[model samples]
Target: MKQKPIHPALEPYLEGKVLLVNKPLHWTSFDAVRKIRGFSRITKIGHAGTLDPLASGLLIICTGKFTKKINEYMGMEKEYTGSITLGASTPTYDLESEPENQQDISHITEEMIHAATAQFTGPIMQVPPSHSAIKKDGKPVYLAARKGIDVELEPRPITIYSFEITRIELPVVHFKVVCSTGTYIRSLANDYGKALGVGGYLSSLCRTRIGNFSLEYALSVDAIGAEIQHLKNSYIPPAGGYTDAV
Candidate 1:
């Protein structure tokens, strides 16, 4: 395979840099950052936001001085597209848990799905899932949940910029959502099921955008590593190392 040239600017990762990476499925946000760190000597790197291992999409990675702006980038609104399966609920609110309490979805209609979205639009009170990474007593709630411990959580306000139905099967609903930074789409799925009087759980999720960054422009792990290698070998050199005459 032909090697792609590295951008001139990426060589100075220690100074500061921002990279748009397309996170792969089953990979945590930190996993992507670790791969990038391996490509360079810079160790101040951090991802602007977190994506669950089950979700894949745009991940903004910052190095050196740019790491300070992670919170700012994380606060921006996000866009996601995914499928939710109705008529069954899960302990984790997604396929990560076993499907339970199946209900008849034959009675659900497209009109009902469209009309139900109105209730979730704009400002709404949302409760995060119990199996989430939220902290309780200085420990992650999911950790407690895995031990069969029940945790009480209060509803917090979140804004849903827009919610649209992209497709529908009897028990599966594919949709797009633009929501605030703290919004949990899993909660939205659970609430949506309650609205229709049929339990539901998230089956698949893919984040498409974050603020102005889109996954379409992101590079894969291998592509990024290769670019970094190219930069170090073909361009950058050690401070005391001298090159041969051109």
Candidate 2:
């Protein structure tokens, strides 16, 4: 979809400022960057990290010269709060896909849920979700998976610093997790369910933190655009407000 044009004021800030944006759910990280670029009226905008379409949270965007710092931010740890529906499996490992079936989860206990979380903490091997953006044979895994092509993907190591079950109601579990950069929460949800002898898939996901930045510091894309419009043809300013908010 074509993005609307930027407001007049923000054109000036597009020159070389970093933007902290709160990415909305169901929007790709690229979508957020594109929107920001449109608002800032700069062609040199980029995001530090990628967030799944089902995830929402802080998305650090750099414009012009600030784009140099993208790699630095991408390496930071991330935190998330999400819900997993137990007793079900989805092709996408999330609510975005059709669930194959729902298992009977009446026997699951709160204690088991708590214990299951521990297994995922610390270093663990995780297989990337088949319906993910991960490249396999030069094509996104999701594309191959959708084409009914079975691809062999090995499990790789990823550290999960923390995984806590905040709430549990039979087949639904709410959790908060802090982990390394490459960790995939959807895969975690799938693995967690399997560990418990049931199935599970991510129902909702919200990124709370990424490295030193948090969602608390992010500006809505509209708000950032408004600020951009207020600055206009003036020289773009430093990312003072951007850093402070994140």
Candidate 3:
């Protein structure tokens, strides 16, 4: 059997490296990690946080020894920018499920929308969407939800440091949020709409920051793959032929 080549460029990844990835829409956080692991061939790799397939944005990928810091990163505050579609609610609280229970947003003024945010700001108890990965009876709650089974979830306390309304176009409301680690923007959207006496759901979401790490520094999955390939191509075997150990 042939051993894999060891390149100096790849050494840092093995020792430990924190990578910022711009997770693509419909791609789970694990998808990005799997791609990086496949290309880099690093067995010890994990992401700092989980991003739903419906959302896209900054995903912190820790490799090798850096994987230990996953919890630390996960505890950091997160920032997101997205739009909430009012006048309808979804079972999933987002586009993951079909919108239902439509309402009229004609009377929903900008003043009312802005006021709604204040109620959600600061500390609040949020009930996660039914179509979520939260565990119940050793199974994901979403599984039972898909089977049309109701699984009552307790409201968990979360803090919203800030919730700023950026734009308003009747049914579509654009906003930015900075919140605690476990805060769910989907729930925020839903609650905000209900506060205004109209239904709402998360239409689009993008995480822009996690603590000091920003999406601005993130690279796409393909870009990271190209980097790994470049490193491999630049490797040169020893003069006496490659050895088994580095």
Candidate 4:
């Protein structure tokens, strides 16, 4: 579905700048970039990282010459907070797919949940979810998975600096994790459930930090467009209030 215009102030993005944006749920990382690109009429824009449509949080965007710095930001460690639902599994690993038959999570204890976290605190091997952006034979795995094709993906190395269960409410486990770049939190949720033998999947997710950049410094999509619209045009003189928010 097509959405409304982002903001009229986007033309200011033509000048080189790095922006911290709080991505909204169900909006692809590309969607955010497209809006900014169109608003600024600048074709050299790009994002530093990708976020699943099911997730929301900090996204670093670069424009003009700053786009060259994308790889540097993408290499930074990431921090995320989200909930995992025990007692069930999902094909997509999150709310994107329907849940399978649930297991008996009643027997799970708070101590077990806390103890299980230690197993994932260091380096680990994680298989990207079938319904993820990963490609198999040049096509996205999700396209084949949706057609009932079973794709056996290889597990790769990823480091988890820390994993903490912040809250436990029966079938739901709230957590905060710090990890290296390229770590898939959904896969982590799936693996965590399997470790406990109760079956689990990601229920919710939010990226809180990427290296030194935090969500606290990010502007909403609309707010960013508004800020850009406030920029001085070629016909106008420089205004005193215009300052780099990043």
Identify the candidate with maximal TM-score: 3
Per-residue lDDT over 1-246 for candidate 1, one digit per residue giving the tens place of the 0 to 100 score = 232333443547767888999998899999999888777656688998888888888899998788899999999999999988999999898878899998998888899988999999999999999998899889999998999999888899999999999999868999999999999988898889889999988888888999998989999988998887766567644486544311
TM-score of 1: 0.91
Model 4 spans > 4 angstroms off: 1-12, 233-246
Summarize candidate 4's per-residue lDDT along 1-246 as a digit string, tens digits.
Answer: 333333224434544688999999999999999997666666778999999998999999998678889999999999999999999999888889899967998789999999999988899888889987788899899999999989999998989999999999879999999999878899999989999999899999999999999999999888877766665242342587334422
Local distance difference test values of all predictions, in order: 0.86, 0.83, 0.90, 0.86
All candidates: TM-score? 0.91, 0.88, 0.94, 0.89
Lowest summed lDDT window (length 10), candidate 3: 1-10
lDDT of 3 by residue, 1-246 (tens): 232545556878978999999999999898899899878877789999899999999999998789899999999999999999999999889998899998988888888888888888898899988788889889999999999999998999999999999999879999999999888888888888888888899999999999999999999999999988887777786798653333
Candidate 1 clashing pairs? none
Q: Which scores greater on lDDT, model 1 or model 3?
A: 3
TM-score of 4: 0.89
How many backbone clashes does every candidate have? 0, 6, 0, 2
Model 4 shows how many backbone clashes?
Answer: 2
